[model samples]
Target: MNEDSTPQSSTEPARPSSGWDRELLEKLLLEALVEQRKARRWSLAFRVFLVAAIGLGFILAFKPLAQGGLTAPSKAHTAVVDVIGTIAEGGEIDADTIIEGLREAAEAKGVKGIVLRMNTPGGSPVQSAYVYDEIRRIKKEHPALPIYAVVSDLCASGGYYIASATDRIFVNPASIVGSIGVIMNGFGFVGTLEKLGVERRVMTAGDHKAILDPFGPVDPAEKQHVQQLLNAVHQQFIAAVKAGRGDRLKDRPEIFSGLVWTGAEGIELGLVDAVGELHQVAETVIGAKEIVNYSHRETLLDRVIRQLGTSVETALTKLATSSPRL
Candidate 1:
């Protein structure tokens, strides 16, 4: 008989194929159970991690208390508020933040005096005015509490406007101080465009709408109007200075002529009261001589979000507000 043609047995049951063998099945079941347990543990761990991260973020966002929560004072320490940076919206130093810090100092227990550690080359006139108003308001509310402006570097223009509201201003000998002036400055590319054979297409509904368009010829009438506007603001600045400084300011022609002077000259010119440092001023103001900062600091995440919003708003308003610097 050919082996290829041989038939299989009929009565003998064929051995079952490998399906769900007891040992193999048991092994697989054990592995699956173990994997499920591990998966559950990992899921629980991930959930726990998320919860912890969220709680931490919340603490960071709202940790500083209402009354100088950043630091607790032991005695009647000199509460210091920093006005360090350009006095403008969206900067480290601004009306809102400065006022917030001032409020904190006002509310803080046993705060002897408030020191404004100012360092700025000036910025937005409106922003500076806001801060100045707040300072005056605070001073009015807390007449007994002394507020001092201690300049570190360039305390010019708007910086001076804010400082003028303080009880007294102390500056380092070489510090640049004073710029009690308002200015409007921008560039005109009309001549360049004309030479380049380019025509600027502009349309406005109002006569003075396109007043200082950089790409077009500057209208003399518009220029005069803008100068008058600057002079008005300058007058306001001068009034603020006079109101704040009172009779301390010397009657000098160059005092408010947009000229900056050294701290030593500022004293002679009566733009500044005295020459001193933070520690010395603190010691002079408060009995304890211990100083505590009460500045409103933006968190890292908060700053990023603020900048994003500000950048978008500025981009939208840039063309509309192409006027001078403040």
Candidate 2:
């Protein structure tokens, strides 16, 4: 057989040993390593970003955690106890809440005095009286600690009743004060029910169980009883004012006739000690240059929860407003 035509020996290889194969393998290995490094870096970055996001979420969830110790110190020598909104039971400015705040302020080591910030249209007489008593007790216990009441916008009725227990009352010139009286409000639906031929089947074991029921006719005896109770509350209110204001209060029945007066008139009538705002009382009257708020600060999470509750309340209010009156 010719040399070129004969098949190569089976044991001998005919392929060429080119360097391109080795070079290609090296390039693939390097590319793989680079890809691995990039993947590792991406994973690390993702982990870092995840941790940061979680931390931010926690901070947002618990705002108070971020504001740690902010409200720990009592501001200045004077602690402020804000009495905003209505002075009704179960309210933020109710007797229980105010009393607790006052007690805390009184017990705080840094607080030398208390400033009762009053801004309310007033509410339940019973609740107001409870707060008044608590204030008086605190005053008696801490005779040296001065308690000044600073009235804003409107401080009438029960609000004034509470202010009466303070050592001194300061009000802005346009602020409304006074209204030393008791009032109970309820609708009477007896006539309406009768006209509509609707019978109320309310039953009680006691004769006075339904004394103030709107669907029933108001008994003369019940009316007298309620009046007497209100009158008693009014007398207690008068006594508190007399004790606080002493000889300063003018001897006028009109003062206790549920008559609201401006701050200018109140000062003249001794219903208020002076006319001033909160800043004036804090800076000039109390002579405190720095203020530290000791009021309970809601955490970020708590504020969110409170906001949700307020939203619910607003919805309920809207629903009630839209509904037909009974």
Candidate 3:
């Protein structure tokens, strides 16, 4: 047989890969890589946000510690104690808080004098009385360290009661100084309930237990009893003012009433000693303008507000980065 005629075996052409194979594989790989990158970025961003939030929280938490130093003052400085907001039993300006500040100031070395920065509309008579008594006790214990109350926007009612116990009260000329009276306020909704056909159902063990309940009928005897109670409290309030004011108070019948007065008028009526602000009082009276606050840590309200701001920032960052850009 001729070499050429032996005839070579026919071999089939190699089949091209399936149309979907290369394209689909590349598409899937690209999609996976992109998704992985996005996931990584999101995770990094979330971690950053978390870290920033934590840092902010720490800053706010320790800010108060950085501001206050009871025993660390090596030089003469005016110790400040803030009595802001309502002076209630459970409030920040309560007896325990103020007393704590006063004690620290009493003990702090190089402290020439203490200043009570009061800005309150007043609350809780019992709380005020406690603070007043504590002040007198502190004065007796540390007669050298005088406490001066410096009033802000308002120092009325219980606020004034607390200030009265101090050696002197300094206030801004426009500051509201006094509301030397007690009041037990309530609302009577019986007429409204009757008009709306809303039946009132309330029970009490004692006859006079719910005397001030708005749903009940008015009792003349209860009213008289309440009035007498108010009168007794008023008398005590008057006595306290008289004792605190001593000869400084002028003979003014309306001074002990519930009427508020400006700082200027308060000075004229002997309710306030002089027109001055916190720093001014510190520089002039304490002879040390550098202030050192002895109050408690930063307020809960400040923390809440800061937390809310951080949350908003984190949310906005996530929203901006959640989607893919072109």
Report the number of the highest-lDDT candidate: 3
Specify the poorest-scoring 10-residue window by lDDT in model 1: 317-326
lDDT over C-alpha atoms for residue 195 of model 3? 98
lDDT (CA) for every model shown?
0.83, 0.79, 0.85
State each candidate's clash count: 0, 3, 0
Candidate scoring better on lDDT of 1 and 2: 1
Instruction: List the pairs of residues colliding in candidate 3.
Output: none
lDDT of 1: 0.83
- Tens digit of per-residue lDDT, candidate 3, span 249-299: 889988988999999999999998998898988998889988888886446
Please tell me which predicted candidate would have the highest TM-score against the true structure: 1
Q: Is candidate 2 or candidate 3 better by TM-score?
A: 3
Ranking by lDDT: 3, 1, 2
What TM-score goes with each of the models? 0.73, 0.68, 0.70
Model 3 lowest lDDT segment of ten: 63-72
Predicted structure 3: clash tally = 0
Candidate 3 versus the native: TM-score?
Answer: 0.70
Write down the lDDT that model 3 would get: 0.85
* Candidate 3, position 157, lDDT: 94
